[model samples]
Target chain A: MNAPILWIAVPFLVGGGILFLLRERYAAWLGGGTAALLALIALVIPIDTALLLGPVSLKIAPSIQILGRSFELNTADGPLLAIIYGLAALWLFGTEASGTANRFVSLGLMIVALLTASIAVEPFLYAALLLEMAAMLVVPMLVPPDQKAGRGVVRFLIYQTFAMPFILFSGWMLAGVEASPGDLGTTIQAGVMLSLGFAFLFAIFPLYNWVPLLMEEASPYATGFLLWALPTFTTIFALDFLDRYTWLRTTPQLTNAIRFAGVFMVASGGIFASLQRHIGRILGYAAITEAGLLLLIIGLGSSEIINLTFLILIPRGLELVVWALAIAIIKGRIQSLRFADVQGLARSYPVAVSSLILAHLAMSGFPLLAGFPSRFALWQQIAEGSLALSFWVFLGMFGLLIAAIRTLAVFVMAKEDAKWEWNESWVQTIMLGLGVIGLFILGLFPQALQPFLSNLAPLFEHLGQ
Target chain B: MVTDTVSWIAVGLALITSTAILISRDWRVSLGALAVQYLAAFWLVTRHLPLAMGSVKLIAGWMVIATLGMTRLSLMNLEQQEEDAFFPRGQWFRIALMGIVVLVAAGSAPRIEAAIPGLGLPIIAGSLLLIGGGVAHLGITSDLLRVILGLLTMLAGFEILYAAVESAILVTGLLAAVNLGLGILGSYLLIAGSSPLENEDEL
Candidate 1:
C-alpha cells in the first residue's frame, strides 16, 4: 500500500463521502474520528520498512503515481503528517461547539488533504496549483450562504491566485539557473520571482491586510483553520526550496532579506494590534506577529532553527483553536466582536473569556504558557546575534501583551450588580478547559515535543546544517 | 503546433474580446465576450499542448461563463434588463488608457522576449494586454461581476504564457479546476450579494 494514497487520498475520499452520507449531528464525531484515525495511522506507519502489528506485517510504499506525476510521503514526513492530522482533528472536534459543524467538518477535512497533497506532490512546482485549489475551497467556508462575500475573501483569492504563475514561472527559470549557475541574469530573475511568489503566499507585511479583514468577516473558527493550515505547509515548502538550492541557502543577501521581512512584520503587526479595538482583529495581528516570529527563526539560519520553528508552530495550532473557540462562543452571544460589544461578557461566559485571555496571553509569550519556551529560545538566539533585532521582537510581544490586558479590561467592565455565570455548555467548557491545560503542560515541559521535532531537519539534506 | 497566421489571429481575437469584456457594462454581454476570449486562449494553448489537454482550457472557460450566466438569468428582473455601458462617464479616459497600455506592451514585447527566450512576440503582446487590462479593471471597479471578469482575464493571460514554458498535464488539469472553482465562487458571491436578506440583516 502507498502511504501518500493512504494518508492523503483516503482522508479526502472519506471527507467527500461524509459530506453526502452523514447527517449534520454526526459530522463532528465522524470527521474528528476519521482525522484521529489517520493521525494514528500516520504515526504508526514506518517508511522504507515493514511494520509488525499483532498478527500481520505490512509495508507502506513511499510514493504513488498518477498520470506520470508522483505524490510522495516518506519516513521523514511521519511527524509532519501526525502534527497536521492531529491538529485537524482538534479543529474538527470543536466544530460542533463552534456551531460550524455542518460545512466545516467536511470542507475542512478536504482542504487539509489538498494541502497535505501540496507538500507531497513531486516536481514541487505543482504544489502551487494545489495550494490555489485549497485556497479556493476556503471561499465558501469564509463567506456563509447568507452573507455576501467580503473584500477579505476576494483579496485572499486574488493574492493566492497571483502567487501561482509567479511560482510556476520561477520553476521554469530555476531550471535555467541550475543549468547555468554562473549566469547572473538568470539567477537574479529566478530569485526575484521566487521571493515574490513566497511573499504573496506568506502574506508578508503590507500584503497581510487581508488577515485582519478576514478575521472580522469570516467565522473565527474557519479563519483560524486557514491561519494554521496554509502557513504551516507553506513554511515547510519554503524550507524545502532553501534546502534544495545551494545557491539560495549560501547567499547572505537572501538571509538578510528574510530577517528584514521578519522584523518588519513583527514590529508592524504588534503596533497595529495594540491599536485595534476589535478582539478578532487583534487575534489576526497576533497571528501575523507569530508568523513573523517563525520567519525570524528561519532567518537565523542556525542548526537549531528547524526545531525552534517547529516548537513555535506546535503551540500555535492549540492557541488558535482555543482563541477562535472563545471568539466564536462570544460571537454567538453578541452581534459584533468589538471591545464595546463584548463588554461585561466575562460576567456571562466566564469560561470562554478566561480561555480567550489565556490564549491571548500565551500568544503574547507570557510565562508558563505554550508560546513562552519557543519565544525564549528565539530571543536567546537573536540576542546573541543582534541586540537591536531582539529588542524589536520583544517590542512586538509587548504590544500583543497590551492588547491582551486591554481585552481583559473590556471583558471585566460589568455593572456592579451583574452576577457571574457559566454561559458555555458542558462540552465547550471541557474542551476549552482541556486546551488551557494542554497549553500549560506543553509550556512547562516542551521537551515532550523533542522526539517528534528533533529529526525533522534531516529530511532536508542541508537546511539546518 | 499552430501556424504563424493562426497564432496572430488568435492573439488579435484575444485582445479584442478581453477589451470587450472590460468595456461592456451588461453582464450578459461581458460573459459572452469572455467566452470568445477563452476560445482565443484555447487556440494559443493548442500551439503548446495536446488537443485533449488544450480543449480542457476552452471547456473550463466556457463552463465558468455558463455558471455566471445561469446565476444572472436566475436573478433577472424587468427593471434591471436595460443595458448599461461600462465606464460610461469616463469613456475617453478608459479608451486613452487602453491605447497607452497597448503601446507600452508593444514596445516591451521585445524586452520580455529577450528575458525569456523561445516565447514569441505574439504571446508576449497578448499576455501583456490581458494582464494590463485586467489590472486596470480591478483598480477601477469593486463590483463582484467585474472583479471576477478581471481575475479570469488575468488568469487566462498567465495560462497562455505558462503553457509556452511548461506542458505538464497535471498543471493543466489543476488550472482548469481553479477556473471552474473561481466561477462557482464568483456566481455564489454575486447571488449572495444581491439577496434582500443581506440588507435586512445589515439594518
Candidate 2:
C-alpha cells in the first residue's frame, strides 16, 4: 500500500465522488470527515514500515509507480501531510458556515490532493503541471454561475499558466547546468527562469495584482482556501528546489534576491492593504504580506529557516480562516464587502467583528497573538542583519495594524439608536470563538508547535545540514 | 533528424492557420482556422509522439473547437454578415503588432533552437509563434472567448514543445486532460457571462 495514493488519491476520488453524488449539505461533513481521517492516517501510519493492526500486518510503502513515474511520501513527510490535511479539514468544516460548502469543499479537496501529488511526483518538474492543473480548477470556484470570469481570475490563470513553461524550461536548463557545472550561461539562464517561475507561482509583488481583485470577486472562503493552499504548497515546493540544488541554496546573490523580493512584497502588500476600503481586499493583501514574510524567512538562509517557515504557516491558516469567515458572514448580510456597506455591523455581529479585528491584529503581529512570536523571531533575525530592513518590515506591520484599527472603527460606527445583537449562527460563533482563542493560546505559548515543527527541518536534509 | 518537405509544409500551414484564427473577423472562420491549426499541430506532434498519443492532441483540439462553437451559438447571436469585423476599428494596429511579433519569433527561433539543441527548428519556430502570438492576443483582448482562445493557443504551443522533450504516457494523458478541461471551463464561462435573457431564451 502506497501512503501517497492513500492520502492524496483517495481523498481526491472521494471528494470528486461527493461533488458528483452528494447533496450540498453533506459536503461539509463528508469532506471534513475525509480530511480529518486522512490527517489521522498520516499521523499514525508510518510510511515504508509495517504496522500490526490487531493480528494483520500491513506495510505501507513510501513510493508507488504509475506509468513509469513515482509518487513517494516518506516518514519525513508525515508531519507535513498531517498539517496539510488537518488544515484542509479546518477549511472544509468551516465551509458549511461560510455558505460555500457545496463546491468549495469538493474542489478544495481535489486541489489539495493534486498539490500533494505535485509534491510527491518523482521528476520534480512534473509538479509544475500538477500545480497548473490545480490552478485551473480554481477558475470555476472564483467565477460563479452566470458571472463572467473576473480580470483577477483571468490574470491568475494566465500568470499561473505562464509559470509552467518557465519552470519546465528551467528544469531542462538546470539539468544542462548540472552536466557542465562550469557553464556560466546555462547557470544564469536556469536561475533566471526558476526565479521567474516562482515569481508567478508565489504572486510576488507585481504579479499579485490578481490577489486582491480575486478576493473581491470570489467568495472570501474560497479565495482564502486558494490563498492558503497555493502559497503553502508552493513554499514547500520551493524548499524542495533549494534542498535538491546545492547551487541554488548556496548562492548569496539568489539569497539576496529572495530577501529583497520578500521585503518588497511585505512592504507593498501592507501599504496597499492600509489603503483598501474593502475588508476582503485587505485580507487578501494581508495574505500577500504574510507570503512575503515567509519568503523572507526562507531568504534568511539560516539553519532554522524551515522551522521558521512552518511556524509562520501554522498560524496563517487560522488567521486566514478567521478573517475569511468574518468577511463571508458580513458579506451574507451586506451585498458588498466595503467598510461603508458593513458600517455598524459590530453592533449586530460582535463575535464576527471581534474575530476579524483579532485575526487582522494577529496577522499584523500584535503581541499575545499567534503571529507575534514568529514575527518577533523574524524581526530579530533581520535586525541582526540590517536594522534598516527590519524597520521597513516594521512599517509594513504598522500599516496592517492601522488597517485593523480602521476596520474596527468602521465596524463600530453605529447610530446611537442601534441595539446590540448576536447575529452569527451557533457554528460561526463556535468557530470564530475557538479560532480567536487558538490565536491567543498559540501566541502565548508558541512552544506547543515545537514538537511538530522540530522534526520538519530534517525532512529537507541538505537545508537542515 | 533531417526535416522532410511535407513536415515543413504542415508547419507552415499550422503557423498560417494560427495567424488566421487571431485575425479572422467572423467567429466561425476563426473556429475553422483553429481546427486547421490543430490538425497541423497534430501532424507536427506525430514527429515526436506515437500516432495514438499524437491523435489525442488532435481529438482534444477538435473537441475544444466543438465546445467553443456550441458555446458561441448558445451565448451570442452574431449577424449573418460575411464581412463583419470582429473588431471593426483596431484591425490595422493588431495586424501591425502581430507582424512584429511574427518577425521577432522568426528571428529568435534559431537562437532558441541552438540553446536547446534536441528540439527541431519547426517545433521551435511553431512554439515560439503560437506562444508569442497567443500572449499578444491575451494582452490585446478582454473578451472572454478571445482570452480563452489565447490561453488554448498558448497551451497548444507548450504541448508541442513539451511533447518533444518528454514522451511519458502519463504526461501526455495529463496534458490532454488539461486541454479538455480548459475547453469545458471556457465554454461554461462563455455561457455564464452572456446576458441572462439570452441564456434563458437559449435554454
Candidate 3:
C-alpha cells in the first residue's frame, strides 16, 4: 500500500491484531505507535498515487467503488485525513499521558480507519457500514466489562446504527442515475437521505443527548475520540455527500433549510451548554454547537463559507483536544467535573487554568483567537446571504460567545479553594504552551493559511455551486 | 405474483414481531420476535437477488447463518432466567393500531409503485415496524441493554428495506459484521464473567 493508504489502514490492521494478541496492555502501545507513524506519514506524504500490491490496485481519486457503489477521496480530503490521523496520534499518546489502558487507543485507531475508508469508499452505502463499525468499536472502548456499560454507549450506538439504513437507501437511490451528481432525481434523494443521515449522525434535537451522556460516562480520552473523530468524520462525509449531489447545490431551498438547521443547532446547543452543570457536559454542548456553526457554513453553499468551514475545523479540532486534556486534568485531580466540584481550581494551577481559558476563548470565537477569523468570515457569509437571517445568526453566535465568557468567569477566574493543592507538572505546562501558540498562530496570521486554504477553494466552489 | 405474496407475508410477520416486541414484557419474547423479524427480513431480501443459482446459493448460505445464529441466541437466553417487565396491554394495542396505520400509509405511498415489484409492501411495512418498534423501545424502556436491543431490531428492519432496494453484497455483509460485532460487544459488557450490573445499585 502507498504511504497515505497505509497511514489510514495499517493502524487498524496492526492495532486490531495487537488487541487480539496482547489483548489490552500492549495494544495501546502498538496502536499508539501505529497512530504516531500514520500522523508522521500524513504530514509528509500527500494523498496521491495508486498502490499496486500483489493482485490489488488501491486507487486514490475523488471517488472509488468497493463492491458496487462509488466513494471519492479527493484533494479536499487532505486536511480531513490529517486531522483524523493527527487526532488519532494525540489520543494514542493521551492514553500513555494518563495511566489509562490501551483499549481506547485500539478502538480509536479502528474508528479512524473506518472513517478514512468511509471517505474513500465508492457507492457511499459502504460508509454506512463504516459508521456502524465505528460505533461497534466504540462500545468496548467506552465501557469496560468490570463496570456496567452505561446506557449511553448503547444509546450512542443505537443512534449511530440508525443512520446507516438511511445512508444506504440514499446511495441505492442514486444508483440508477448517471454517476455524476448532476442528475436531479438522484441528487434530490441523495440530498434528503444525506440530510436525514447527518441529522441522526450528529444527533440534533431529540436525539442530541447521547453526546453529553456519553461524555459524562466515558473515559475522557474516549470522549476525545468520540468528539474529535466520529462527528468530524460524519461532517466531512456529509460534505462529501453534498459534493456528490449536485442537486443539493442547485436547490436554494435545501441550502436555506440547512442554514436554518445549522443556526438552530448552534443556538440550542449553546443554550443547553450554558445550562449544564458538569464541565464535561459543558464541553459536549460547546462541541455540538460548534458543529452547528460549521454546518451553517456548509449550508451557505458558498466558496468563502466552505473554505472557512474547513479552516475552522483545524483550530476547533485542536481546541477540543486541549479542552479534553483540561478536563482530564480536572478529573485526575478532583475526580469530579461539576462546577461546584471544580470550584476554586484556578488558584492552585494557573497554567492549567490559563490553558483552559485559551481553549474556551477559541471555542467562543474570541477576538484575536483561533476561532475568531473563521467565525468572522462565516458571519460575513451569513450577513451577505440574508440580512434578516444573519441578524438571528449573529445573535446566536454572540450567545455562544457569552457562554464561553461565562465558562471563563466561572472556571478560570474563580477563587481557588483553600483545600486543593496543585501538581504543577511540566506536562501541564507544555500542553498550556502549545494551546497558547496554536491560538496565536491561527488567529494573528489568517493570511499565512491562505495558500493552503485557497488550494482547497476549488473543491468548496465545486461543492457550493 | 408468488414472490409478491411471500414478501407481503414476511412483512406482515415482521410487523407482528415488532408489535410483539412492543407489547410483550418478556425480554425472551422480544428476542424471539426480533429473530423472526430478521428471518422475515432475510426472506424478503432473498427475493431481491437475480433469479439464478448463484443468488440462490447466496440466499441459502445467509439463511443457514441466520438460523444458526438464532439458535445460539435462543439457547443463550434459555440459560438466563430473569424476565423483563411487560408494557401495558393498552399501550401495545395502541401501538399495534398505529403500526397498522403506518403500514397502510407506506403501502399506499406513491413510491411504492416504483419499488422492485416483489419487494414493495414488505420492505415498506418492515421498515415501519422497525422504526416504530425502535421508537417505542426508546420511549418506554429505562433499562439500557433492552433499549439497545430494540435499536438493533429497528436497524434490522431498516437494513431489510435498504437491501430490498439494492443488495450490494459487500455493504450488506459489512453491516452484518457490524451488527454481530455490536452484539458481541454489548454481550461482553453485560455478561462477560463480570457485569456492569453487579454494581448497578452502587452507581
lDDT per residue for candidate 2 within A1-465, as digits (tens), equals 788889888989987997788888788999999999998988888778898989999998899888789988989888889899998998999988887747788888999999999989988888988998999988877776767778888889889988988897788778888789888888988999999999999999899999999998888888998999999989998998898888888889999999999999899989998999999999999999999998998788887788789989999999999889888888888899898899999999999999999999999999999999999889878988998789779888988999999999999999999999999999989988988999999899999898789868768989856
Compared with the true structure, what per-residue lDDT tens digits does model 3 show for residues A302-395? Answer: 7565577777877776787777777777677786777777766777766666677777778778888888888888877777768876766666
Question: For candidate 3, what TM-score does chain B get against the true chain B?
Answer: 0.67
lDDT of 3 by residue, B46-164 (tens): 65544442243334334433543454464454334334333444674657665664656476544654543555655666666677667767666655456656766666666666666
lDDT of 3 at A104: 68
Write down the worst ten-residue block by lDDT for model 3 chain A: A59-68
TM-score (second chain) of model 2: 0.87
Instruction: Judge candidate 3 against the unseen true structure and give its global Cα lDDT, from 0 to 1.
Output: 0.67
**Candidate chain B TM-scores, in order:** 0.88, 0.87, 0.67
User: Tens-digit lDDT track for model 2 on B28-111?
Assistant: 887888888888788778888999999999998999999989888875554433245347667777778778878987899899
**DockQ of candidate 1 (2 decimals):** 0.49
Sorting all predicted structures by lDDT, with the top scorer first, yields 1, 2, 3
* Candidate 3 Cα deviation (angstroms), residue A331: 1.1
Question: Ten residues in a row with the worst lDDT in model 1 chain A?
Answer: A455-464
